[model samples]
Target: MASANATQSVYLDYAATTPTDPRVVEAMLPYFTEIYGNAHSGHRPGRRAEQAVEDARETVARILNCKPSEIVFTSGGTESVNLAIRGVTLSEKGDSAKHIVSSAIEHSAVLKTLEQMASTNGIEYTLLPVSQEAVVDPETLIPALQPNTALVSVMAANNEVGTIQPISALAAQAKARGVLMHTDAVQAAGQLPLDVQALGVDMLSLSAHKFYGPKGVGALYVRDGIRLTPSQTGGSHEEGQRAGTVNTPGVVGLAKALQLAYDEFDERTAHYRSLRDQLIDEVLRLVPNARLTGHSEQRLPGHASFLLDGLDGNTLIMHLDMKGLAASSASACKTGNPEPSSVLLAMGVPYETAFGSLRLTIGKDTTETDIEYSVSVLAQIVEKLYRLRQNYR
Candidate 1:
């Protein structure tokens, strides 16, 4: 029951979600209290609320370098992913375009949606394998595409291992084959460049909570000429793409948070990389048989995942929490599954090694002191566990 540092608690789970910025809260305040009119109503208050929604859409469009009309608001990353994949495949003209090509290490939102479609809608998909570094090779993706392939979906980065994928390269190949490309940018939204034109993707997904914005709000970027079947019907909201009353305050918060993140991107990433590298180096040096999981150089600045030999990942997480250091065994989406991470297994990690996985993602508030304390706590826990195992054996 000893505290990790005996001084303070450290949170290294930014990949799960981020603490919303106070500035974003400030921007969203008026919408909740004063401008609380329905966006679709034909009245003065409604007009004002509609303007605010449009303004927020414009802000998100500017960030993604897409037209405002191409952006559709959704509940969160899961909805965005579902919409992008299902909307396209279910369109009126989509009967002949049912096959999809994607990476094996995609987030479950993407994988599960595909599985659902395959079961009920006669959709077929190919999941390309990744390298040992957890990167999807563009060369491997080419053969996965078929004459009937409709879309190529891949994540901008690995949610669990933090490995950055070659999205541009993958999208380019899809484009050359006359196929549409989509990327789930939930994990990469605030930390990575999201210029849709540059990424060569026809559609991209974003979740506000990943970038210090409110939860329950996300956006899907579709190119101007792309056609999609409305996933949620009955209203003209989101240009008839989704049906529901617009979340004015949440959208305002999303825009403000994205603006602040990009404005401070250089400084924030430098801070994250500094602390992250220190933690990684110290943990590997101090703990025997510890191995870094993702691509060492191409991973997220704030992300560091690893495999600790001869330890259960969940057990390690419990010990870290007891010591006042918060972390994860894998993606928060798969928290209670009790199964080894599919991401690591897809990257060819042995099942036993995959069970020892640990993920520590630093955030804007992380510091050198926090990283130092986290490393000390993690090393001690691993050493103690190893000693106990030796004695038991």
Candidate 2:
């Protein structure tokens, strides 16, 4: 295959996950060999581990502008999302509260948890609709809010289309109504500027792997004074919220990666935007019937999703891969799921168009040459697919 041609390989799937920065790995090296210790233990090694965990917490807090005591370590984004939504709704006082208001475009973590809550706990929920651009207006939540509403869970940015949500407006409305607000910021963690206080959200989720840190480690920020029932009951780790052995290196890596991200924010954002805009413009010009998804300007710096009317997204992905360009049809979470992306459907895209959704997210390492090659190959693939379909017809 041409993909094996070495020089042609281009990776454009940063939205799914990122390559862990070597600097983060260097920071974490000692934890596994020299500094290995259970964070919960009281001895010297344990105390050392505990100090690392606390330092990581402070680093994360510095970026989010939250208190260190408010951060809860977890496995990853899914676990953090579940803990934030379920932990609150299932709390002693929260059990009586019944409704949740969120957008149809939320990550499946938020949507599925709400679904389970509605089914098992008899809690009521409403999914606000999105525009054709796959964005939810903040005002949509005003009418959905009810006296029984307990929490409002939305994403700071979408996993599929990379649409930025009006978190401040949504959180402000929820706060005025005395309802709690939570956001799945896994996709937005390092790509966009995130300050929980500025966003007016009581809770937020961040994953290390989403921002050039290791996988299997993430954190949830719950505003100080907010109470949540423990998801896993046992040890008093994570302020008695989650129970498990702390991943010492993972914690250190998360902080180190986030610190690097904060330091390189402006430079990275500009680079990503340049590649993203170049790709979008070239694809629209080169491929027939191509339509861009999500808000044109409000989208993430590295995101450029699309719907090509006459081609199948999966087929296009395979063709791109054979040419040594890596991309995805949608969220990585939906891998092996045959159905079209629910995110595109929620945006009112036609069934056929949803099947053709293509997501190509750039990263800090992406280059001008990679963008040019991807566009050249993509145009050829789309043309070839159309010809094959016509021959079949």
Candidate 3:
């Protein structure tokens, strides 16, 4: 039995990627062995693989509340985002307009691709700002819409701050103006309830790793009737939307992960919220001059981001790691660089505060004891670092 004083390490970076659940592992084992086959083959082995892929696609589609035909399997979240943004822009019918609207807080995958399109393809774009709560204002986008605007891409939830966006409202606004909408929902898929129809988005992106499935597999939901140009060319696969041999095991794992996510979403959310609240409460009680980041109530259930005054986030993270608690200074994707978090900058966070940020995301396996222990360990480290900084000053 687990206890409060257990020697096991605590991992609080679920936003980066979750460990594969045993159930998902079980679901994927067969695909890797007896059922292994090329989804494109016409033989018995091929037929088995093809059917498994189709079934996985259906499972993903059902979770998103979209048709199976709308789901296109890709390598991961980056590919899905690239395909959604570039595919729509490149496939636009006319030459009169070539512009897009996205936020500054988007992942590098989305931002870098848009930047490349702007430079090489002459695709002009606008990057909107976010509030202190890290939520983008839908009204800010109204004045930016041009007749040439091909699509508007925004994240459903911020990876660093965990602030949920007003996706439905934003998508509706874009739709009313005849512009397409796409959202990078990699961080929100399993943590929140998703309904593509209700969200009113033309395209959506999700990755398996973020939801406790295997890495290197993701899906894109393209609304019916939206024309998209294929980025990769090969024989007809994924209905010619995406091409290449499908990773049968990866797809099977993703479907199982998503199914488990949906089946236990309510209970998991509640459990994580309870632990998150306990963490925040204990941290505030034990640590001085630590402030929570992101929206107080509108954030993800398990996301607990904060800034510790006068302490370098990287140093703090290292200290915590030495103490056997794993956390991140910001999004795992943006770490190891000296620059402050772009998401925090977009929300108008000062450079100093942004540099001192830490993100601790709980998960299904996290317990109150884990939160308590983590808080205790972090408090000791922060105080030591703060004293050292003060002495140097």
Candidate 4:
């Protein structure tokens, strides 16, 4: 049950960003105060900071089933994706091949970088479309792969629709063709089990904050023996692949968060899954035109995206806000834009339906009562918005 003293309001935007866990905050406090020092400095303080960074790297590696040296810390998901794409593209092999394959529904971090490269003639890119179920067909990707295809990038899960991709299958295909495979696993990390080796991805990106850690820190996993050029040039940090001072405090918080999430994965998954199912059931029961988006069964544990006909998603968001329920129309990164969701568009949803989409993601902190209240509020807002649209028509 939500306490009457709960601060702010009900937060349903975990897909956008989650509050830093109290445990993570506690873990980070020492670094900010007593252990304040640059990881690059040459002193006891620096050594302590450097050790903390290494510890965090090991924790991240353990979670992903990769070597500690394979994890390159970056600013966040965006930087990780940029580094993975650009580094590979600038590599000797990538420069010669010049062709890349990805999904149309990838986060803008991937799409935008690929677009910029495409414009420069540095790479020829292909974006495979998704079906109405938000699943990309592996067969379609096979046809798009050229002999010179240097890399294939797909997301482990779609951030907007929560559609889990068949990454292992896709990676296997890329492997057979001798092309490297990368996956943006930012949204899939805590909600799903991630084993880079099992997934057969040559590279994977993850954000700490997405799983209850501090912001401004993330990691990229590079499979052993994969050669790539450094995207950022500076100090010999991150095995000389990435430069600049390590974010020691953020890394510590991330490692702690990752460890906690892994420890509680099964319990948290079950909890969020139950709440998610309940929310879906209530919305379908109460709302006449509510349609669930994404893979109905293969979706992320906590993601619940729906389209309410005749209701503007922005309007519904505002209404839900007024009722103290937080949600979004698409990925938080793409929110506040009037454009229809690229993910939805690629999934064959009409523009009108795309504009009517709402994404509500539950988290570890989300309670059963909270889901009940949010569902009740959403049903009411959708009905009200539909009637308003009808009247205007």
Candidate 5:
């Protein structure tokens, strides 16, 4: 049962960002106050900071099943993706290794970088189409591969609708033809079994904030033999692949958070799956002309998304906000895009339905009462929005 004086607003937008864990906070506090020195410095204080960074790297490497030297720390998922794509481009046999392949529903970080590279640097890219459920068939992607393709990038999970991709199979397929494979695993880091060896990807990216850690910290996993040119040229750092003073506190927080996530994976996953199922069932029962988005059973355990007729997602989200329920209409990164979702359009959803997208994701501590409250609140908001739209029509 919920406390009578408990919080009013339900945070159902974990896909956008999750609150930092308290254990992670405890782990980071020492780095900020006692060990406040740049990792680049060589003094005792700097060496302490550098040692903390290396410890964090080893922790992350343990989870990824990769060597500590293979992990490159960055600001976050966006910077990590930018580094991966650009680093590959710079290292590729110039002109000959100009082509790349990716999925259409990838995050803006991937899509935008590819666009910039293609337009400004003369790189060529092909985006494979997805099913209406926002999934890529390896067959579609394999056919688009070229002999000169430098890399093949795909997300482990779709941030908008939470569709899981077959990263292992896709990576195996891409590598068979000598192309390197990369996965934007930002959304899947804590939610899935993300063993790099099992996934077989040459590169992977993760953001700490997405899994209850501090913001402005993330890591990229580059396979042992794969070489990437430094994206940011500066003082040697991150094995000379990325350059900057390491963020000791944030990195420590990230490792602590990831450790907690793995330790509690089963229990947390069960809770999220139950709440997600409840959300889906209650919405379909209460709302008219509502259809679930993405693969019903294969999506992230915490993700619940839908499309409702005669409703715009932004408009619905506004009303939900007033009612103290938080949600999203599209990928959080593409919030202001008035156009229909690129992911939905790629999935072949009609413009009208795609325009009405709603995504609600639960987090590790989201209680049963919270899910109940959100479902009730969402039903009310959808009815209000439907009536308003009908009256206007």
Candidate 6:
């Protein structure tokens, strides 16, 4: 049963970011006040801080099934992706032409970094088309690889549409050709099993804030024996891969948050799937022309997205906001842009219809009552918008 005062707006934008878990906060408090020494310093307090950082690294490495030395801490997912792609380019040591292969629906962080590298460093890239459900076929990737290809970069899942990619198969293809692979696992980290050996990727990226940790901190997993040139240079830090004074509190929070998430993965994912299914079913049933986006099953358990005829998602989101319900029309990163979602466009949705994209994601604190309230509010908004359109016509 919902509380009598449960009229607060529902937060359905977990894909964008999540509130920090209290346990993670508790773990991070000591680092902020008492043990606030630089990890690079050699004093007693510094050694203690360094120990905390190393322990946190071990925790993250254990979760990702990689060596602690392979885990490189960065600002967040964007920097992690940038470091992986840029660092790989710098390490290739090739006089030959360098090329990269990636899917069309990648986040702006990946796409924009590729664009910048192409213009500045003379690195070439190919954006492969995906299926209508936004899945990249590994068969298509083989033909795109070249002898000079430095890396094959793809996301583990679609941030907007919630479509899961066949990462292991894609990684296998890359490895057979002697090409390195990297995946932005920011969206998939807490919700999916991310065993690095099983995934068979050379590198992967994750952001702490996406999985209920503090912002401004993330980790990149580089497989043992994989060499990446340092992206940030100054002092020797993060094994000389990233150079800076480390955020002891943020890293501690990241490790604690990931530990909690890993422990409750089964229960949390099951709950999300159930609520997600109900949210999808109820909205589709109660509203006309409500088309569910992404794969029906092979998607993140907590994610649901849709398109509606004769309705723009931005306008619908505004209406829902007025009704005490929060949601997104596309990637939160691209919010307020009147343009249609590139993810929907890549999925073969018509340009006009793509403007109607809506993404709703469940989180750890989301409940059945919240789902019920969200669906009811969404149905009402859609119906009213349609009626208004009919009258105007």
lDDT of each: 0.90, 0.89, 0.89, 0.87, 0.88, 0.91
How well is each residue in 225-246 modelled by candidate 3, as lDDT tens digits? Answer: 9867878888678888887888
Candidate 3 collision pairs: none
- Give the per-residue lDDT of model 5 (tens digit) for 1-393: 233233378889999999999989999999989999998888999999999999999999998898998999998999899888889987987676899899999999999999999889999999999998988999887789887799999999999989999899899999899888999999998899879999999899999999999999999999987778877789788888888878899999988998898889999889989999988897898767778999988799889998886588888888778877889998787677788888888999887778889999999888888877777777767777778777988
Clashes of each: 1, 0, 0, 0, 0, 0
Each prediction's TM-score versus the true structure: 0.97, 0.97, 0.97, 0.96, 0.97, 0.97
Write down the worst ten-residue block by lDDT for model 6.
1-10
Per-residue lDDT for 233 in model 1? 79
TM-score of 5: 0.97
lDDT of 1 by residue, 252-354 (tens): 9999999998999999989989988988898889767789999999998889999986688888898888988889997887766688889989989888777
Tens-digit lDDT track of model 4 for 1-393 = 233233236788998888899999999999998888898889999888888888898998998998998999999999999988888887746356898999999999999999998887568899998899889888888899988888899999988889999999999999988889999999998999899999999999999999999999998999988766777788888878898888888999889999999999999999999999998898888766999999999899999998876567887888888888889997787667888888888888888778888899999888878877777777666777778778988
- Give Cα distance to truth, residue 194, candidate 1, Å: 0.9
User: What lDDT is obtained when candidate 3 is compared to the true structure?
Assistant: 0.89
Model 6 bad stretches (over 4 Å): 1-7
Tens digits of per-residue lDDT, candidate 2, 308-389, equal: 8857788889888898889988687776567888999999887766888889999999998888888888877888898999
The positional error of residue 120 in candidate 5, measured at the CA in angstroms, is 0.6
Q: Which residue pairs does candidate 5 place in steric collision?
A: none
Checking candidate 1 for backbone clashes, the offending pairs are 4-323
lDDT of 6 at 288: 75
Clash pairs, candidate 2, are none
Best by lDDT: 6
